[model samples]
Target: MLNLNDLRFFVQAVDCGGFTAAGRRLGAPKTTVSKRVAELETALGARLIHRTSRSFTLTEVGRDFYDHARAALIEAETAEAMVRRRQAEPSGTLRLTASVPTAQLYLADHLPALAEAYPKLHLVVEVTDRFVDLVQEGFDIALRSHFAPLPDSQLLQRPLAREDIVLIAAPAYLEKHGTPQWPQDLAVHAGLLTGPGATTWRLGGGDADEAVEVTPRPRMLADESVVLLKAAAAGLGITCLPEAMCRDELARGAVVRVLPGWTAGSVTTTLLMPHRRGQLPAVRAVVDFLCARLAR
Candidate 1:
């Protein structure tokens, strides 16, 4: 087999004009450099150079080989430098997947700061409700929101935050239907629900907990929390959504929280990554950024 190192030496010898000069440039003995080139030629069964006492010249094959060898060496060096730079600083494309609501409500807003901090990092975000196979799908990280602890999986999960689910309704809806004083009052009002457990709202904080199963008379049934939020704000019905998702509307008084002292449930926001040794700096940077920002 032709040794890449030997090819490198041959290219350096050609570029430096002679074996002695190439040896000095490479910090190797002239005889050692000459011997490696001879081995490379022997491996390829071709005479790559013609030598004299004073100087060396390339054979017809040597000229063609030198051009290719020099280009290869340049490419190899460039690749090494790029990897080293990436190791030292976060620089590369990071692929992330998250639910549409989490992506739109949380990650979408915070990604700009991450980009600003790591200017060399490129982001490819995939937003979908479907659970993706990280290894098969080639995702670097995944952000998920779950009411229940995630089941066992090969992917590593880091809990980012426990987000409260607040019940909200448009002022018009609240005024016309009359505000619900208790969890049971939600049954008579139009309900905008999300996911399979839409009709089942487990409310309250401590021992005062109450489980209210409203009839599935949903005005809107969707997987995305944003859709449910918009429906609630449009006076379609009251819906329970992540507080983070409805913070703006709640502050603007576009939508008011129903049952102020109660919450439906809290979902744990988690960061998921494939288990691997030595995570890339870009991936580590994003993870740390999220943990810092979202944990607040």
Candidate 2:
């Protein structure tokens, strides 16, 4: 294996003008520094220095080699610094926000580990679907679910999950109401819809350029996803939810997907943070932790 100490020794020798000077700075004997540099040249099968009694100079290849060796040392030092920075225990309040569906399906799963790892780091999480301004709202970071590109802003975005919005209903509901074979048939079933009041549902899929819309005439309406999920599982009516959020329900037969090839579009879960917040160790720790676990 190539020794990193050789790279350090070689770089120091070149910068300090000679092995004797490099050794004084590195707290090693001049002979040891000279030996390490020779080993490096031997490993590469090329001479890196023209040595003499009075002074040493780099050969043509040695000059080129020195540039790369210096660059490598800088990169190695930077990598070590970054690892040390991340290892620093981050402490401070980290204010965060996310849509309800994203919190339940993705963020909730990984946040516990982050909290446990950095007990000194406090978290204040807001769950909502509103488009919150990170700067104006004083939020350090936010998680958002977007169907389209977010409006251009100063915040930075990192994707956490790409969730397909699937329609689901209880088996009892499907058997009693009969499965909808097409998008138009969706109108006939009782709809347990999200958001307040009644509105048309638009689904996009099935090898089509255009989306399909239907007015199911919702018999129940609410803004909460868990409420809708529970209602659908209780044989109330068909509703839309992220497929990942419905995993347990689908597995337990509490709910089954409907309209296999069709979907209520897709949602991208993203982490957003202000540009200034990126420099904070607390924010960096939380962002790194979430990205490591939640990124898909």
Clashes of each: 0, 0
C-alpha lDDT of all candidate models, in order: 0.81, 0.84
lDDT, candidate 1, 111-186, per-residue tens: 8998898887889999988878775455779999888999998878899988788889999998898998867787
Off by over 4 Å in 1: 1-88, 195-197, 206-210
Query: So what's the TM-score on candidate 2?
Result: 0.66
Q: Residue 277's C-alpha lDDT in candidate 1?
A: 12
Best by TM-score: 1
Positional deviation of 224 in candidate 2, in angstroms?
A: 1.5
Candidate 2 worst ten-residue window by lDDT: 73-82
Per-residue lDDT of 1-296 in model 2, one digit per residue for the tens? 67888988987888778999899978999999999999999998999999999879998999898777766765665465467567767776789998777787777878888899988888999988777777545688998887897887888888877888899999999999899988899888989887664467798888878998888868799877889899999999999988887889999999999998999988888889877566667787888888888665
